[model samples]
Target chain A: MNASEEYEIMIGNHAAAYACKGAKVQVVAAYPITPQSPVVEKISYFIESGELNARMVRVESEQSALVACVAASATGVRTYTATSSHGLMLMYEILCWAAGNRLPIVMNIATRAVGAPWSVWTDHQDAFTVRDTGWLQMFCEDNQEIYDTNLQAFRIAEDPCVYVPTLVSYDGYILSHTFMPVRLEPQSRIDDFIPPLKHHLNLGDMNVVKGVCPVTTPHVVKREEGTAPGYYEFRYSLQRAMEHSIEKVVEVHDLFAEKFGRSYGNGIYKAYKMEDADIVIFAVGSVASESRLVIDKLRAKGIKIGLISLKLFRPFPAKHLREVFKDIKTVVVFDRDVGYGYEGILFTELKSALYQLKNRPFIKGYIVGLGGRDVKADDLINGVLRTIELEKKNEYVEQTEFIGLKLDELDFLKKGGKVENGR
Target chain B: MTEEKDYQKILASVQKPVEGEAGKTGSWSTIKPKINLDKCIVAKMEKNVCHFCWLYCPEPIITRTIPPRILYDYCKGCGICVEVCPHKAIEMVEESEL
Candidate 1:
């Protein structure tokens, strides 16, 4: 296999599809959703063209899609699925069940905002909602990272240390639809990286049906004992594996970099220009890309500002985040989604992580994009600037603020007057 | 032949309940379905069409005799029988420890 290959322009969804192919996934079950549909489409094309030999189960719903994948995985086949916002929401219960049973199914989730007010745009809310469902969640910054992360997710999920399903997420429209130059790894190398799956239980044996049993009385003594290893022990082991994943993630990234010639940082958080900064801007996904431009502009103006891009949202990365921002005096968190009647979800988690520190920075939460609203570089710059001003005054902003709200439209408030209603 | 023996052993291990053990509802302390006699179509008419609970119970905990009765000891509290009963005869009641 030739190592020096020309860069191919591929969207994040296509990159994920290629990674699935590279992983040698034997079974794929998917239902179409915006931005995520192309992934399954490409894989189906691959299957049709004889490039990949896999069973493509066309399922009715996302729940059935995951159920089919779980059943496939239990039969010792490498299985994968992809879904986004509402589709991911539909698979919530099954996601928990799959992980609880220690199935190593890989799912690529294109991050999109959940609807009710119905907008098909990008946000982290969908992925963040199911953060605790025992799946290893890895967020990518770009198309290449999305490609590499999906490959790594399969290896990590199937590892005996971590036999839980993993979701490799890239922002819906921002990364999924946007085409970028990505290096495709040779199938031979990926084959080496991720081995053929060895299932904990095989359902194909005629004598005994492993893991499946008739529903018995709750008072059944053996059933009580069976619940422990099936539920608690499996969950505990998955948690331990996720906690241990920090090092494994780094190792995989390093090896991938060495083999494929590209690697993102090993830690949960990726810091940029943070070495000697006093104030830092924290964001994820495409907003973080905008934040980097804002940081560069601020740095040019002789302002001490840095950016922390969170790559892994789950396992929360609380300890690493504390260490990264330990020296900084003020931190600004830009959130794309807002938890109703509360601060942004990312801000709340960050605050809880940083609460125990003896001398913590004044972490300001700024709710920004929602429903596909574009966040410009200037908006990020202004948010950081506000944090810097607060640092100068040595006064902490107790309230979470909206970064770009149209205040002039409010009839109750006069021009240039603070609205009586406080958020 | 070996596989056939294993199947036979597994099937043998699954205990078959003895006669008169079917309708004894006293053992169910965790979850039990109650029949509202007035609302029960079968019980009201003294007919057997309302054997829906007995039919729908995945565990087959409810047995149909002259009238269907729940064998509470074996019920796993899935409540499928309660939800599927056409006459609304079966109401799943949470078992309380005295």
Candidate 2:
């Protein structure tokens, strides 16, 4: 379907493809990985069917796929790519290069579980691992937000003040596979919204002298006046850029709503049932959307509970969250994934963000629905109840709890197991 | 903070990948190549035509003079001229020795 059509029923991957097409991305180089493969497949279909005018490079590996996009973007072309967990891991090297070079490359990630035993389920572990790589990280909760955010990502990333690469991540099967209604904006409106990409380095002309992070560095000084900055200064610029990015994100989000009549809580977060509420549940991705149902159910039974869905993950939206949670008594964070040797990654980030505030709430972390396990409304309520019960005590509540786990079976293994060590 | 008597050369821009304009890259070479003109190829071009050393040098400073003189200012001492000399007319001496 053309971008002129507004409403249609499509899966999340197809919605992503529609956004890339509407943005008129010039180059798409992606490797196939499950859950995320459909996004690349749909884009390739658009290219092959003569509907979307773009070059689709089917690379051999994820590293090559991102490098190809980096190369195309170096010449000032808008580029796109998509990948799942292990595929995202494989691209770690070039991913850092793309962001470090400030290429404004837009990529979609179908967030999935990383493998040791190899399970293809939705999780936030993959995205959390690369949060510091200098790309704008956005977590979308539904198909419509996925479609809209992908469209808006081009404007936000290509903004001269914030020329950092942006990653749009949605849940693996729950959102990527499920059919949902999405509204596609008109092509002219999208073109009006996001203009042609302008390169900071302007490598389009060869005579200007260009190389991607040239070698032989440590004090091998170029007598030329514009030698590269010290590594520390280069990284410091990115940190400053990240600090300035939240303003651009809000501007884009507000402009998008003004043009098409939609709102996403000023592009940082969406708070539900927060009015006159004492406690709130915080989550990201599909879990955030799922919590809405639980919030509605709890509010009806005289429960002063609210829900806060994180729309942007990176640059962590600290100020916005600090303002929202100032009055709340407790915040129950469901991570759906764990950070080794610590609590949930999002939970850790939340506590750290809220630490400097005047009236900080008692925040609790729970690892739930890992590896695609069902996290129903009832399961979420149990976690919330545990937090409430712990609130009335003078004792310490555990920092992290793994919800819906078969602890008895694991306990049996711990109590009565043979210790065979190749003797 | 002690940079050899507090010398700091401030840069005007962040990394411009200057091509042939990066002042005299020959300072990058550790081994200075000394060409022996008695057996040089381009020096004996009147006797026979062989200038492989000039053709194979990766730097722009190598020229085809009577003895195919290597410009030490930009030679970078990369020994390619020594290795590519058909007549075995060039030898790489350590820069300290030179």
Question: For this target, which candidate reaches the highest TM-score against the unseen true structure?
Answer: 2
Best by DockQ: 2
Candidate 1 local lDDT, A310-356, one digit each (tens): 88876678888888877778889999877778888888888898987
lDDT of 2 at A144: 94
The residue-by-residue lDDT of candidate 2 on A90-178, one tens digit each, is 99998888877777899999999999759899988898888889899999988999999998899998887788899999999999999
Quality class of the docking in candidate 2, CAPRI style = incorrect
The Cα error of candidate 2 at residue A100, in Å, is 1.4
Which 10 successive residues of model 2 chain A have the least lDDT summed? Answer: A211-220
Residue A44 CA displacement from its true place in model 2, Å:
0.9
- RMSD to the true structure for each prediction, in A, is 9.5, 7.3
Q: Model 1 in CAPRI terms: which quality? A: incorrect
What is the clash count of model 1?
0
